[model samples]
Structure formats: C-alpha cells, structure tokens
Target: MMTTIAAARSAGATRWTLTSLSLSMLLSSLGTSIANVGLPTLSEAFNAPFQSVQWVVIAYLLAITALIVSVGRLGDITGRRRLLLIGIGLFTLASALCAVAPTLNLLITARALQGLGAAIMMALTLAFVSDAVPKPRIGRAMGMLGTMSAIGTAMGPTLGGLLIYGFGWRAIFLITVPLGLLTGWLAYRWLPADSAKSGARRSGFDVPGTLMLVVMLTAYGLAMTIGRGSFGWLNSALLVFAGVALWMFVSIEKRVASPLIHLEMFRDPDLSACLAMSALVTMVMMATLVVGPFYLSEALELDAVGVGLVMSVGPLGAALTGVPAGRVVDRFGARRMTVSGLAAMVIGCFALSITPAEFGIGGYVVAVAVITSGYALFQTANNTAVMADVIADQRGVISGLLNLSRNLGLVSGAAALGAVFALASRSVGSNLAHPDAIAHGMQTTFAVALMLMGMALVIALRRLKAHGR
Candidate 1:
C-alpha cells in the first residue's frame, strides 16, 4: 500500500512539474516581446523620444544579460525550486510596478526589475525541465518548451496591439500580473523540493567575480547602446570601461575557487562552437525584430493592429517548426540541422536585403517567416547540443551561459542594427516625412544583416567541420 501511494505521488509530481515550468517559460518569454508593439504608444504617453523609450526594452535586456549567469550559479548553490519561486513572485510584483509607473524613468526601472526576475526564470527553466523529464523524452520536452516560448513571443505584438487599442500602453504590463501570480503559486506547490545535490552548503558564491561580470556586461551594453548619433562609436567611454572590466573579470575568475563562470568550459570545441552559433543566430533574429515593425509602420503605413499581425508571422513560423525541429535534432543530430538552418537564414537575409520596395507587406512577411523558421531549427538543435555536451552537475551554469549568449545577442543586435538604420537614414537626411529615405535606411540595414548572416553561416560550417559530422 505504501509503495502504491509513493508511485501515485511520483506520477502526480511529474505531471505538474512540466506544466508549471511551461507557464513560467510562457510568461517570461511574453515579457521579452510584448512591449515592442507599444513602443510608439509609450513614447507618446511619456512624451519622450524614441531613443529614450527604447530603454524600456534595453534596460530589461541589459539587466537579464548581466545577472543571468550569477543567478544561475545562485540556483546551483541555493536551490532551483527556491530560486524559481522567488523569480515568479518578483516578476509579478515588478509587472505591477511597470503598469503603475508614471514617468518613463520609473517605467524603465521597473522593467529592469522585471528583467531580473526573467533572468532567474530563464536560467533555470531548461535545467529544471531536464531534471524532471526522462532522458529519452528530453529532446521533445525541450522542443515543447521552445514552442511555448516562440508562441508567447510571437503572440506578443498582436496581444499588445489589442490591449493598447482597447485600454492603453499600460495594459501590456498589467496583463502579465495575473499570469505571473498564478504561475508562481503553481510553481511553489508543484515543483519538487531541492535535493541534497543542490550543494547549498558545499559551494561558495563568488562576489568579486560576479561584480566584475556585471560591470563588464553593463559597460559593453552601454557602449553598444550609445554607439550611434551624437555619441558616436569612437568617443564612448563605455568601451574603455568594458575593456577594463573584462580584463579584471578574467583575472578574478582565474583566482576564485568557485568562479561565476567556469572559464574552462569554453575549451571544449563543441561547446564553444554551439555557444558562438547561438549568439550569432540570435543576433540575426533581434536585428529583424527591431527593424521589422518600424519598416512595416512607416514604409507600408500599417496601423498598430496591422503591424502586430505582420510581425507575428516570424514567431508563428518558429512556433510551428519548433517541435518538428526538436525531433529532427534527436534523430539526425545537431550538426546537419544547424548547418541547414543557418543556410536558410542566410538565404532569408539575402532575400530581404534585395527585395524591391514595391513587394510591400507580403514580401516582407515571407522573408521574416523564413528567417524565423531557420531560427527555430538552429536554436533547438544547438540548444540540445549544448545540453548534451555538458555534465549533469554543470547544467545550471551552462543553462545560464546559454541564456547569457542569447541576451547578449539580443541587446547587441538591437543596438548595432538600429545604429546602422539610424546612420543610413541620416545619410539620406533625417526627415521622418521622407519615405524614400526610410526605405533606403531599411534596405541598407538588411544588407548589413545579410552580411552578418553570411558570416554566421561560415561559423556554422566551421562548427560542423570541427565536429566532423
């Protein structure tokens, strides 16, 4: 009778664990893309410039990028379940703060806090899922997680538009409040308790290393943010700060007993290749995301709803492909899928760059969908490879590192690609009324993206060769 009861309890826990994790993944991923549709509304409401309002997005991403690794390491030391619960609670509260914020500054601050919560959640969701699911089904589970994230992200623009149209820009932030709270409650109840293997008492947090990493990431992100306009790339002090912080961080990591990042992890050629490919692919995705809405709104004269629908195409494509791609990864291995996906992205980028302005919304939709489909394939395969390469005990930190790569790509891609568009627009005269100039700028930006994608393809090819598969 005791054995039967134990089996029933175990079965119950298994069922609820994935559901809770998926909810957390959906909310966190939703936050990343939801605000995008409201960017113009936010600028108008706060009476701020586009550049200032962009921080609503940037601050969130920067906070996530800077803290993900540390928080993941913390999860390793404390307990993943504990950290996940705290993350959900914090995220819910921060979403409330964001909705209520009066000033643009306060909104950005709240978003940063929201990002901190997201970092914790993002760092652990995969690790938790991997731990809970059986080995044979891990690939499918990851694919499903990816699908949830893709759906959430893809749905963001449409949802945000509808909310903004019905309520206001604040509605975007407010909507997450209920979802986050419910997820938190479920997580607290459903997630299994931390085991002795969590190493809570065995490991020590690396304070100096953590601090240096924050400084480095902050400086680097700031440099990228301010690289354009009056600041210009050459005169930014943030670059020097980034350089100094990086040197100090490397030095400190070498001396620390338990570094925030295990530097030696990069020595594995497979791991390094997977990480690099992840960053580059994510960079391409962000470039499209940042530029696509503007192009649709300005070039095609689309309304908020129209823009949202159009932007949804890419993520929708990714969502559809995610599960199938995961199965492919499980069967055929990562190298082939990664290479094919990168090639597809390269083709998509090239198509977008050369597409005639006359092709309008339809052409753009096709291009974006192709890009996202490629991303879905590449991400699933590469993520699976990354997890496969690392040891079981190191999953937490490695998950953190993987998320770090993605966020870095996100932040850098937005800044750099936005800068390219800004400069190109300036070259054609910065008049917002000039459709020709805007078109020119958009084309130039995509051309640059094409070049970057080509480079990524080369890297993927090299990675494939290195693995000899």
Candidate 2:
C-alpha cells in the first residue's frame, strides 16, 4: 500500500511540475512585450514625459539583467524547485502591488520586483522541464517551451491593448496575479527536491563577487538609461561609475573561490561565437521594438492600438518559427540554421528601413511582419546554439548569460535608438503636422538596426563556414 501511494504521488508530481514550468515560461516571455501597448496610456496617466515613461519599461528589464546571473547561480546552489516557487510568490505579490500603485515611482519599483521573479522563472523553466521529461523527449520539450514563450511575447502588444481598452492598465497586471499564484502553488507541491545539478556542492556564497557584479550591471544600466539624455557623453560621473563598476566586477570575479561566472566557458570556440551572436541578435531585436512602434505612431499617425497590432507581427513570426527552427537545429546543427536566420533578418530590416510613411497602414503592417518573421527565425536558432553544447550542471549559468546578453542588448538598443530618434526629432523640430521629423528619426534608427544586422550576419556566416570545415 505504501509503495503504491508513493508511485502515484511521483506520477502526479511529474504531471504538475511540467505544467507549472510551462506556465512560468509563458509568463516570463509575456512580460517582455506586454507592457508595450500600455506605454502611451501609462505616460498619459502618470503625467510623465515620454523619456521618463520609457524608464518604466527600462527599469524592469534592467533589474532582470542585473539579477538573472546571480539568481541562476543561486538556484543551482539551492534547489531549482524551491527557488522557482519563491520567485513565483514574489512575482505574484509584486504584480498585485503594480496593479494598485498610486504613482509611477511605486509602479516602477514594483515592476522591478516583478522582474526579479521573472528572472527566476526564466532561468529554471528549461532545467525543470528536462528533469521532468525523459531524455528522448527533451528536444521536443524545449521546442514547445520556446514556441509558447514566443507566442506570449508576440501576443503581448495585442493582449495588452485589448486589456487596456477593456478594463484599463491596472487590469494588465491584475489578471496575471491569479495565474501566478496558481502556478506557484503547483510548483511548490509538485517540483522535486533534488533538482540541483548533480555533485554540485554548496560552497559558501561569494558575497563580495556577487555584490561587485550587481554594482557593475546596475551602473551599466544607469549609464545606458540616463547617460546620453541627462549627462551626455562627456559626463564625468557617468563615465566614472561605469568604468569603476566594470573594473571591479572583473577583478572580483577572477579572485572568487566559486566565481559567479565561470570564465573558462569561453574557451570553446562554438560557445564564444554563440554568446557573441546572442548578444548581437538581442541588440538588434530590442532596438527594433522601440523603432517599430515609434515609426507607426509618430510617422504614420497611427494610434497606440494600431501600433500594438502592427508591432505584434514580429512576435507572431517568432512563435511560428521556434519549433521548426529547433528541429532544424537538432538535425542540421546550429551553424546552418543561425546563418540562414541572420540572412532573413537582414532582408527584413532592410525592407522595413526603406518602407516610407506613404505606404499606408496596410503596407507598413506587411513590412513589420516580414521583419518580425526574420526575428523569430534568428532567435530560435541562436537559442538552440547556446543550449546545444552546454553541460547539464551549467545550463542555469548559460541560461543566465543568454538572458543577460539579451537584456544588455535591450538596454543598449533602448538607449541608443531612443537617443538617436530624439536627436533627429529635435533637429527636425516639434511640428506635429510635419511627420518628416519623426520620419527622419525613424529612418536613422532603422539604418542603425540595418548596420547591426550586417554585423550579426558576418558573425553567423563565419560560424557556419567554420563549422562546415
């Protein structure tokens, strides 16, 4: 009787565990793109300038970037299951706080906490999925997670817009609270206790190293977020903070007994290229998000809802592409798929760059769809590359680094593109009737995106050829 009960419990736990992890991935990816539709609404409600409102978006991403690595490592040190549940609970609470916040400052702070929870969910979802499934099904499981995540991200704008129009911006955060709470409860009850990497013993946490890393990432975020706008390039304070933080981060990591990051991972050529490609792709991906919406609303005179629908194309493409890309990667290797993906992205960005406001709303929508499809293809292939060569014990670290690279790209993209558009718009001057100013700004931003794609293309092509040899 005891044995039978234990077996049934194990089966039930496996079922719930997979379900919970899937939900976690969906939520994390959803957050990345969902708030976009509410940007205009939030700006109006909070009585904040556009640039400041942009921080509401930036703050969450910046927090995620700064903390993902630490949290990923800690998850491995502790148990992935326990950490995941903790993250979920925290995230749920933060969501509630965001829903009821009276001021922009409070909302931003709550979102940051929400981001911390997101990092935990993003970090452990894959590992936990692998643990629950048999080895033969791991590839399929990963592909499914990627697909669902892509769908969530792509649907963010549309979903957000619908919610905003129907029930207001508060509903956007509130609706997720119940889902998060349910996922957390399930995870706690079902996730196994021994989800840590095998033979990975807990050394005392590297307190100093961790602090330095956080300081470095935080400084980087601040500098990127405000350096160009508030201080300009010549600001001594900005330069000093960024420089000192980076230097200290490097120095601390090199000396720590159990380093937060294992520098030795870069020794493999494939891994190095994968990391570089991931960073570049992310930079381009995030930059496009900012530029695409601005172009639609300002240049084309589309409303916020219209921009959301148009912006939805890229994520939609990604959702359709992820599963197929994963299968292709498993069969033909990362090199071929990655290179092809980059080529597609180049075409898409170029198409979008050349598209004029005169093309009308339908034309612009088509252009965005073309560009987004390429984004989807590239992301799926690139992620597969990162995961392919990684050992089981190190997946969390690798996942953290992948997320970090992407987040850093997001920060860079937002800052660089935001500054460029703002500068161009200023030169053209603030005549709302003359879409030319915003048009020129949009063109400039797209050109920059094109240049990024070119670099990524070169890297992906080189990697492909090298692998072929």
Candidate 3:
C-alpha cells in the first residue's frame, strides 16, 4: 500500500511538472506570435512609423537569440528551478509593463526584458523533461512541448485579434499576466528542487565566451534583419563583426575552465550531424512562410481571408501531429523516425515543386499539410534524440544550442530564401512581377527548397549509419 501510494503521488507530481513546463513553452511562443498582430495597432497608438514599431517584434527576437545559451548555462551553474521561477516572474512583470507603457521605446525595452525571461523559460523547459519524466517516455514529453508550441503559435493571432477587437491592444499583453502568474505558482509547487551536486560540478562560469557568443549572435541577427529584406553595407559590416566575434568566442571557449559549449562536442559526428540537419531542415521550412503568401496572393489571386485560412494549415497540421509523432518515435526509435520524417518532407517538397498552379489552394494545402506533418515528426524525433541521452549537467546548454540552430535557420530563411524567391520572380517590391512570373517563382523557390531538403535527407542517412542503424 505504501509503495503504491508513493508511486501514485510521484506520478501526480510528474503530471503537474509537465503542465508547468508546457505552459512555459506556450507563453514564450505566445509572446512572439501575439505581439506580431499588435504591430499595426502599436504604430497608431504611439504615432510611430512601421520601421520604429517593428522594433517591438525585433527586440524580443534579438534578446532571445543573444541570451538563450547564456541563460541556459546560468541555469546549469545556478539552479534551473530557481532561475525558471525568476524567469516566469520577470516575464509576468514585463508583460504588465508592456501593457502600460506610454511610449514605443518603453514598450520595446519591456519586450526585451520579456525576451530575457522567455530565453530562460525556453532553454530550461526542455532541460527539465529528463527530471520530470522517464527516459522511455522522452519522445512523448518532447512532443507535448512541441504541441504546446504549435498551439501557442496557432492561437496567438486569432486570440490577439479577438482581444484587440474587444478590448484594444493592451488586453493582449494584459492577458498573459494572469497566465504567467499561474505558471509561476505551478512551477514553484511542482518542479523538483535543484540538486546541489549538479551546481557543485561546475567550477566557474564562462563569462567571456558567453559575452562573445551574445555579440556574435546579436550581430548575425542584426545583419540578417536590419535591412528590411534588402542587404546593405551596414549588414555587411555586421556580418564582418559577427565573424570576428565567432573567432573570439572559440578562443575564449578553448581556454575557459567551464565552457558554455563543449568545444570537443563538435567532434562527435552525431552532434555535428544533428545540428546541421536541423538548421537545414528549418531553413527549408521557412520558405513556406516567406514565399507561400506571395504565391497565394499574386499568383492565385487569394483575398486576405483566403490567404490566411490556407496559410494556417501548416500550424494546424503541426499541432495535430506532434503527439502522434512523439508516440511513433517512442515505438520505432528516434533514428528511424528521423529519417522517415525527412523522407516525408522530401516527397512533400517534390510534390510542391511540380504542383500545378491551376489547382491553387487545394494543391498548396495538401503539399503544406504533408510538409508540416513531416516537420512535426522530424522536430519531435530530433529533439528527443538530442535530449534523451544528454547528461543532467549539460542539458540546459544543449537545449539552448538546439533552439539557437532553429532561430538561425529562421533568420537565414527569411533573408536568403526570401531573396531567392524575389530574385527568381523578378519582383522588385510588392507584386511588381506578373502573375505568371509569381507562379514560376513559387516553382523555383520550392525547387530550391526541395534541394535543401535533399541535403538534409543525406545528412540524416549518414547520421543513421554513424549510429549503426
């Protein structure tokens, strides 16, 4: 009876622990998506130009990219549970500030602070899974997190639109405050206390490496984003600075007693392969977001509502498939599932590449659904493979690295792949190219996207071989 009762209580605690972590993922993703819908409203409220109001979104993203890994390392050295609580609190407070800020600059500053909290939340949530769940079930746990992310992404715009329509823009920010508070309480109540042994294992923090990485990542993000889809000299200068920062970071990491990332980890073929494959996969995934809207609007003549409903199919598919993918990963093994997912993506991309323009939304939706379902599986399997075997001490930083690779892919996709579409279509600004030109552009972009997916598939196969699959 005692053993049974103890087991039951333990299971209950695990459930709540996962609930808190899922909420953390949801809130962080929600922060990103919700704020995007408010940009126009914010511009009018503050009487600022689109470029200035755009910083509201950019600030949050830059902060996350720049600080995610550092915060993850901080969680390792300090206490993940404690740091997570502080992160939830900080995010909550920042959201309140954003709700009340009278100026755009103040709102931007608050958004950056919220991003810092989000970085901690995003980095630490995955790290906590090993603590909260069994090894056999890691895939399912990862899938749950992915599902939350999908749900958050899917819900944000619609939720924001409803809130803004009913109560104005501030309501969107105000709404998160209560959710954050609840998440904080759940975390404090359910999450395991930090192990003293884990904290004692580290001799010191790698301050210099952390700073250099922040500089490198920030410079890279700015270089990709600052020009509004057009590269400039400023972008070139930032890239150069980023290159220098990368060198400095490597040098610092080599000498640090406790490094943020294990320099030698790159020597592991599996680690290198997974990172590269993830970056490549996400880069291709971004093409749909960047190019799909243009194809629908210009080539197919979809109105705003039609375009939105079709574009939503991807996130909806992801949300629906995430848990099932996780279950499949657990049953079939991560390596096999990873490769299978890539194969599915390749087929989807190939179909999209040759899809007839006359089929319009039907063809586009089918291809997108297939692609996103594959993505949902790939993301779950890849994340499980990385996190399942990671040591407790290294979990936070590794999680950060995984998230960082995805962000870099997104940034690059928006810049590089978007450029590929624009140049191929001969479109200058907004719809300067003819309808036929836009249709040709869609075909060209997916052809390039398919090639990228092929490369990722090759990487996945090699990784499978390396692991003796």
Candidate 4:
C-alpha cells in the first residue's frame, strides 16, 4: 500500500513537471508569434511606416537568434531550473513593460527583453525533458511540446485580433503576463531542483566564444532581413561581416578551455544533419506564415478576418497532428519517421504549388494542412533524434542550437522567401497588385519551397543510410 502511494505521487509529480515545460514552450512560441497580428495597429498607433514599425517583430526574432545559444550554455553552467524561473519572471515583466510603452522604441526594447526571457525559456524546456522523461517516452514528450507550440502559434493571430479589438494592442502583450506568471509558478513548484554543484558548474563560462556568436548571429539576421525585398550593399556588407564573425568565433572556440560550443560536436553526422534539416524545414514552415497571408488577402480576396481564420488552419493542423506524429516517431523510430515526414512535406509542397488557383481557399487550406501535418511529424522526429542521445551536461546547449536554427530559418524565410514572392508577383510592396500576379507569386514561392524541402529530404535520407536504418 505504501509503495502504491509513493508511485502515484511520483507519477503526479512527473505529470506536473511535463505540464510546466509545456507551458513554458507555449509561452516561448507565443512570444514569437503573437505580436505579428498587431503590426498594422502598431504602425498606425506610432505613425510609422511598415519598414520602421516592423522592428517590433524583428527585434524579438533578432534577440532570440542572438541570445538563445548563450543562455543555453549559461543554463548548463548555472542551474537550469533557477535560470528558467528568472526567464519566466523576466518575460512577464517585459510583457507588462511592452503593454505600457509610450513610444515605438520603448516597445521594441521591451520586446527584446521579452525575447531574452523567451530565449531562456525555449532553450531549457526541451532540456528538462531528458531529465523528466524516460528515454522510451521522449518522442511522446516532444510531440506534446510540439502540440503546445502549435496551439500557441495558432492561438496568436486570432487571440491577438480579439484582444486588439476588445482592449487594444496592449492587451495582446498584457495577456502573456498572467500566462507567464502561471508558467513561472508551475516551473518553480514542480521542476527538479538543480543537482548539487559539480563539474558542470565549475567549468568556466566561455565569454569570448559566446560574444562572437552573438555578433555573428546578429549580423546574419540583419543581413537576411533588411532592405525589404531588395538586397543591397548594406546587406552584402553585413553578410560578409557575419562570415568574418563566424571565422572568429570558430577560432575562439578552438582555443577556449570551456567553449560555448564544442566544434567537435558538429562532427556527429546525425547531430549535424538534424541541425541543418531543422533550419531548412523551419524555413519552409515559415514560408506558410510569410506567404499565406499575402496569397489569401490578394489572390483569394479574403478580408482581414477571413484571412486570419484561413491562416490559422496550418497551425491548427499541426496542433492536431503533433501527438500522433510523436507516437509515430516512437513506434517507427525517428529515422524512418523523419524520412516519411519529409516525403509528406514534399507532396504538400507540390500540392500547394500546383493546386489551381481556381480551387480557391479550400484548396489552399488543404495544402496548408498537409504541409503543417508533415511538419509536425518532421519536427517531433527530428527533435527526438537530436535530443535522444545528448549527454546530460550538454542537453541545454544542444536544445539551444536546435531552437537557434529554427529561429534563423524563420528570420530568413520572412526575408528571402518573401523576396521571392515579391519578385515573382512583380509586386514588391504594392498592395494593389493584380490577383493573377499574387497567384503567380504563390505558385512560384512554393515551387522554390519545394526545392528547399527536397534538399532537406536528401539530408534525412543520407542520415538514414549512414545509420544503416
């Protein structure tokens, strides 16, 4: 009887721990997505152009891109649970600050702080899973986290729209405050306390390597993002500078006794493949966000509300498929599921590209659903493959790298793929572009996206062959 009671208590604690991590994952993804719906309102409120006002979104992405890895390593050095608590607190506080900001600059700065908190939260949530979950169940746990992520993403636009209508744009930021607070409390009350200090803590933090990575990521983000659809001298300079920073970062990492990232880790083909595939897949995933809105609004003549509803369908599909996808990963193994997911994505890409525009929103939504469903599978399997074998001390940094790749992909997709659409439509920034032109843009962009997915498929296949799976 005592054994039964102890076992039940342990099960309950594990459930709560997983719940806490899911909330953190949800909040981090929310921070990434929710602000996008309010961009137009923000532009009007601040009397700013689209270019200037976009900093609201750009700032958050850039902050995550630049800081996620550093924070991951920091979590490894410090205590993950302790730092996660701080991250949740900071995110909540920043959301409140964002709610009250009187100027665009202040709002952007606050968003950056929120992103910092989000970076820490995002990095550590998956890292906690290896500790909280048995190896046999990691795939299911990943899938659950993936579901929360999809829920948060799908919730963002609609929830933001309602909030903006009911209370104002500030409400969008304000809502997260309570959610963040709840997440923080759950994490504090349930997560495993950091193990007593040992070599993990004693290792010196790699300041130089971390700083150089920040510079590299910052430069790359700006390079990919700036100048609207047109690449220019400034973007070129930034890209070159980013390359230099990478070289410097590598040099510093080789010399550092305690590196922010061990270069040797990249030699693991599975790890490297997962990282690369994640970025590529996420870039394609982000194309849905960047291109879907424009296509629905322009080619399909959807009103703002109608467009928002249709846009949510992709993430909704992802949300619905997440747990099932994770189960599939566990049953079939990550390697098989990974390849199968990419194949499904390849089909979705082709469907989206070739589905006649005459079929309208129905066809588009179906294609989006297919793509997102495949993405959920791909993401769950890929994350499982990456995290399944990481050493305990390295889990935090590995998770951070996974997230950083995804963020960079998102940032790139917003720029590069958007540019492809703009050029294909011959519309650039014109809202008045003809419906036919918009339709053509949609097709062209997806065709390019199809090629990107093909690349990812090749990578996954190679990994499978290498493992003789």
Q: Name the best candidate (by TM-score).
A: 3
> Which pairs of residues clash in candidate 2, taking residues 3 or more apart in a chain or in different chains?
none
Local distance difference test scores for all models: 0.84, 0.75, 0.90, 0.90
Query: Model 1 over residues 173-260: C-alpha lDDT tens digits?
Result: 9999999988998888888788887765445788999999999998888777653344565536887988999999999999998888
Clashes of 2: 0
lDDT at position 49, candidate 1:
89
List, residue by residue over 194-280, the lDDT tens digit for candidate 2. Answer: 643532656745678778878778878877776435546644466588789878877887887888887888787777777777777
Model 3, position 374: C-alpha lDDT score: 93
Query: For candidate 4, which ten residues in a row score worst on lDDT?
Result: 425-434
lDDT accuracy of residue 452 in candidate 3 = 90
Instruction: Please give, for residues 141-230, the per-residue lDDT of candidate 3 as tens digits.
Output: 989999999889878888998899899999999999999999999999999999987677556778889989999999999999887889
* Each prediction's TM-score versus the true structure: 0.90, 0.86, 0.97, 0.97
Q: Name model 4 segments beyond 4 Å from true.
A: 198-203, 427-432
Better of 3 and 4 by TM-score: 3
Model 1 lDDT at residue 385 = 73
